[model samples]
Target: MRTLTELLTITKNGRGRLVLVSAEEFFRLKSRDRRAVQPAELSDAELDLIAKAGMPVECAALDAEMKGYAL
Candidate 1:
């Protein structure tokens, strides 16, 4: 059980990918049958950065995984 305040605190610390979501959206996600909120689709630029960081294979795998859940 994560409170909205804790979510905000984690985002502020730059610990994870941050997404701007409405309160309604947040609660809806919380009550979903699947508790995990899927990761956002990565942009070309972000993918390029990941590749440059020496993780081309990892980035490709991540892209493939995200394809399964199109937001």
Candidate 2:
């Protein structure tokens, strides 16, 4: 399957460049951009739930192993 970026059509214009996308894609992009400016904050209840449900054992093991290795 082609990604959104791959599906996009880009062309050089008189000014610089132009990107052509469908109305749906344009609105999706716009919504994402707006959310990026103001990210949502999690509520206290959500935080409590996350704290109660700790990381999975597999992820914990990976984290421990990664600590022993150099990046």
- Top candidate, metric lDDT: 2
lDDT computed for candidate 2: 0.65
Against the hidden reference, what TM-scores do the models get?
0.24, 0.40
- Cα error of candidate 2 at position 43, Å: 2.3
What is candidate 2's CA lDDT for residue 45?
82
Pairs of residues clashing in candidate 1:
none
Instruction: Give lDDT tens digits, candidate 1, residues 1-71.
Output: 65543444235555765675659667877887655333356677876886787655747767766776858
Displacement of the residue 2 alpha carbon in candidate 1, Å: 25
Candidate 2's clash total is: 0
Cα lDDT tens digits, model 2, 1-71, are: 65554445565664536666667777888887743222248677866886798776768767867786877
**Which candidate should be chosen as best, given TM-score against the real structure?**
2
